[model samples]
Target: MANPHSDHPAHLQHHFVSSEQQFDAAKMGMWLFLVTEILLFSGMFVAYIVYRTWHPEVFAKSAELLNPFLGGLNTIVLLASSFTVALGIHYAQKDNKKGLVINLVLTFLFALTFLVVKYFEYTAKFEHGVFPGAAFDPHGVSHGVDYATYNIPYARQFFSIYFVMTGIHGFHVLVGMGLFTWITIRALKGEFSSAYYTPVENCGLYWHLVDIIWIFLFPLLYLI
Candidate 1:
């Protein structure tokens, strides 16, 4: 007799001979997607490094103004979320539906917290006349003695890149939040099982890619 487990309804896929074949194909596709994403972010990182090198004094000054504490806290939040996402995938593979749901929810919460902190950081900058591009105005540049020492234009350039880079990164976080929400809904509905959770697994891979980007961004933008 055919193995009962092999007869799972999830075993059928229009383009594959078995669920295993479909799972492997999906995993491969997701990895390829992540590779492209890395290349996209690499362009931005290169631009940032080049500009910073060209204006080291300004870059260092801007870095000083950034609250390392907020950046550090967000970093910890993302790392913890990544851990929960990993556990969620592990439990999903084991067909532990409840555990998967719980972990996914925790991941969503962390993402929300990250955005909340980011909002305050951006708002504070704006209030200090740290707007990007032409809107930027250093109130002290015209009055303070220190302004007579450091070049002002260079400072504006640093803030411009800072806003653009972090703004783009924050957009990615929003995308990840949407993905988590979709996967959580499906998991709660019992749409995933040990036999066919490749979609969930693939989504987890995407989330991991986002987390990895933040890892590089943190040190590059804030620490150095």
Candidate 2:
């Protein structure tokens, strides 16, 4: 009793010649999408650089309002998340379903932690009427934080850039959490294994990029 369809995989698309070809094509597409993401973020980075160059003193003084310790803690959390995701991928490749599920869950928790921390930071800014755009108050020191200087319009430029850049990055992190949530359910159902872990692989690549973007953001936004 021989099965004729055994040579073909159920997950393979009809357009693909083979599963390997399908995987390669999917990876290439993900890379292309990541390139577009980089380009988008690059524009923001350039804006930040231009503003800082034009007004270095404003940028530095405005940065004093930020909490570097919180920024550094978030950086560590995201790095841990990236490591857990890599482990999840490793477990998937090894067909260790339990390990994959555990690692993915860990990654999800870490992402949630990042967002929670960001929420507190946002609330602190709000408490001082420090919002983005027209609502922004350059007098962040009105709460008596610095109680001197920093009421100039140039300070608005720094906070505006900070909010926009970090806001977009936070949205990406939220999306990553959602993606991991979906795939973790799949992993629990034994969807991923050595021969068919394309979803996990692609998601990990995306998560890593999210982490890398934050790495650049921390020093640029919080530190000198």
In order of listing, the candidates' clash counts read 0, 0
Candidate 2 residue-wise lDDT, 137-171, digit = tens:
63445446752365576788888899999999999
Looking at model 2, residue 56 earns an lDDT score of 94
Best by lDDT: 2
Q: What is the C-alpha lDDT of each candidate?
A: 0.83, 0.91
Stretches of candidate 2 exceeding 4 Å from the true structure: 1-6, 138-144
Model 2 RMSD, rounded to 1 decimal: 2.1
- Compute each candidate's TM-score over C-alphas: 0.89, 0.94
- On residues 137-191, what C-alpha lDDT tens digit does candidate 1 reach at each position? 7444422233323337677777787788788788988988999999999999999
Best by TM-score: 2
